[model samples]
Target: MNRFRYSSHNLYSLLSQPKSPLHPPTLPSQTLVSLDPSSIDFSNSNQFHTNSSCSSTIPSVSSTGSCPDSALASPFSIKFRSLHLYRGGYIDKGLLVNLYLVKHHCYGTSSSVNQCGFRNVGVNELRYFASHKQVRDILGMIRRKDNDLESKVRSMNVSLNLKMCSRFFEELNNQKRDALAVCDWIRYAHPSCRNDVHSMVIDNLGRLGNYDAMARVLSEFAKKKVRLVPLAFEFVSLSPLKEATVMKVVDVLKAVEEPTRGSGLCSLIKMFSAVGSFDMAELVMQLSERKATFYKIMVVEKCGKGDFEGAADLVEVMRKHGLKPEAKIYNYVLSTLCKHDKSAEAGALFEEMLASECAPDPITYEIFVCHSCKAGNFDLARKLLDRMNAQGIEPRVSMHGVILKGYFNLKRFEEAYEYVMACDRYICFPAICSTLARLYVKADNVIVAHNLLLELIDRGLRPDQSVYTNVFRRLIDTGRTALAEDLRSRLSSIGSKSTMGAG
Candidate 1:
């Protein structure tokens, strides 16, 4: 008795029985606009719209519609029609046996009489194996027969057939289950598979949150000249692991030969600083041995995180690597030191950056001025500002705002006002406007504050609620409730929503 059995079921019954009474085809409610043949030029067919709304113009017959006779007229179509006919049980028994032999031999299965007969029996009865489950079982039996017959065949030709059949089952199994697994099999099984398994692995690994595994795979791929650094960076950036682990992975990738280029390293650096891993970030900088631009950014970032020692170490490393420190890096270091009350060192670094060939830009001078003012060294800050002008680097509005803020900190409103006027003449930046408004509110000059707010509005710049809210709170704190209430109402009338409770 044959181990494989096929059940008898018509193709139409197999395709359509699961659904309810089939609805008759109806014309679309939209009128079909007939194009004038003269206007329908096919020459520029490539210009057709490919968007979803236009895709329905392409016609296709329903799968349940009768197969067209015209499709079965050609030789290739006849072969396809023959397969469909075999699927529909229309072939003679002798022809069925011959076709089975041909299919088995072509696909690298055994050509023995027993195998051919088994195939014949299976093919003839395939209609009876109607359900997908039943078809799967029948294919399994065929696979077993192929595997068993492999040992009996003596020729190289038979071995080739066995290999083909094995591959066929592998493909079938892959199709039946996980696409990723199938992709992996194809990617590693044949050099000609052309599927990028690295991408598939990275995608699945990221989705699964397997960072360690992803890191390992990416490292291996990178060694093989596969560019997985971008994905690796994303994995490390989003992984819920400790910032230290993220930094470690970044360092490892950076050390890897010719790391995948573009944005990967930059994003890693940002992620490190975002998570407060300045120390580890410094290590990454040292390991990468990157250009001045990278080190300058790292130093500035470390300073922002208040890691002064880390910033200092980065400077040392820059000098050790024979890279001249730029004005931006020095400014960041100086600002950080000044904020921490290391005014002497801050001033020294500022002077050193200025003396170097990489002359201090306006931003660098601004940092020095702000630091000096913060340290109650107003004379020094004024001298630096004069020197900056002499060097032909005009102060930006931010520089004026910082000096005004410094004056306000020292209770020198007259000096702050003078700097505000100077800022207006040179560059009228939003920061300058906000600072002046804030100062006006401090001095109870509500009219000037309101005018500055209107100026900001006229310039098409939307001031954050905090800007007005801080001023209102300051006014209220100073026992100027009436003015504060009036300003609040005016702000609301202009669509500035406040988060503060009414007094």
Candidate 2:
């Protein structure tokens, strides 16, 4: 009989289970807080319960219906039941599972070992039950009413199954036109998700001209450990997202210790050009210690926009970075100087452009000619025109119009008329007629202006209200009241007929 008892004890030892699922061994009789039922406040409860069967520490039930050891009770079954109640729409879950997992992990509970699995199961169940199109529709409506709840659900799914989240991003990347989905997936996917959704978003957003979304994606990526490529920087830099937003992204990237030496500097230059924030662009160049061809282009563009000081500063920065200013750069600076009414400086820059090995293009000659005319340097304008002709670059009708307008502005109607006739000889259609009309009106020659108007009409060029008004006022001011009235009636009839046809 003693031998039989020893054998039975050995068999029992073999069948025995481990004490807990958690590592480092869990302590016995520990109280865990329940996050279910959603409305019962347990803040005042100091009760405790035991999990081990080794001890029989029964709690006293008070007359007020409070159990002494309520805190230590195994509330897992109650919480699971509460999830069912929530699914049935009979209770508020309110992220109770998330709260439980967080609290249990914090408190070193053995039950926290299965938190990830449990959350995954909960999400799967939620997705399964909510899969019916009608149910999904309803849930979408409900979610719209409570964005916080929706965010919590998304956060739970991410924390539970990062792989699944990554797959969602992969699917989004394959979509052709659904850029919105790509953007949303990149925004909410877990950091551990394998596919780089952020990069995909950056690429597509740039293509789609969705600058706002691109900036947001850059900001999100900036928070992660992933390395940003030069193209991503370029996308963000060229986007229409504001400087403050771009700066915020830059700050986040800087914190991540991203090296900005290569194409990063080019992106910064483009970004500054887009927003007209040259100082910040220069700061980035200084920090990056790299200069690119795009830097010169950006400076020229700023000069074209009449920002001469910015263009000059950019030139200085380029030289400091050991980059020689090209012909394009000089043209931009000169154009900018002319726009700012600095004619002498502009002339000096033009001379400098010619002296340098960098040859001027047709556009450079046009800028100089126009600026000289505007500055009352008609002689200089003529000189540039002659130089352009010698270089085998024939001036277009627009160039002739510019010179005629300058002569007209200087009250040299005869010279303006001569240029108008020259424009006609060059087969410049509308410019010749428009210039003659203006010159005739200015010289109080309404008959010639009327004839030019008729020629414009014969050429299928419909003059807008400004053109008609100028002609009519000229006729009336020159004492041809009857012709002015007749022209007014004709314009009104034409406008009404066009409106009716459109309708």
Residues 1-503, candidate 1, lDDT per residue (tens digit)?
12112223321122222322223223222311111112211112121222232211111112332222221111122432323322322334444343444442222112342222223332222211023443354345445544432222211121122233234344434433222323333343323212133444454555454556655665566566665423334445555764655556555456445444223455456656667765555556655546777677678778888877677777767887889987768778866776776644554554445445668788777776666565556666666677776887877755666666666555555555445545543334555666666555545554555556655555554344445666667668778788778766665564444222111
Decoy 1 TM-score against native = 0.40
- The list of candidate 1 runs beyond 4 A from truth reads 1-262, 265-289, 297-310, 320-322, 422-425, 429-438, 447-503
Global Cα lDDT for candidate 2: 0.48
Q: What is each predicted model's overall lDDT from 0 to 1?
A: 0.49, 0.48
In order of listing, the candidates' clash counts read 6, 2
C-alpha-based local distance difference test score of model 1: 0.49
Would you estimate the TM-scores of all the predictions? 0.40, 0.40
Candidate 1, residue 63: how far the Cα is off, in Å: 32
Model 2 per-residue lDDT tens digits across residues 178-248: 34532452344333232344444454555455556655555555455444343444445545664554565
Error of 1 at 132 (Å): 31
TM-score of 2: 0.40
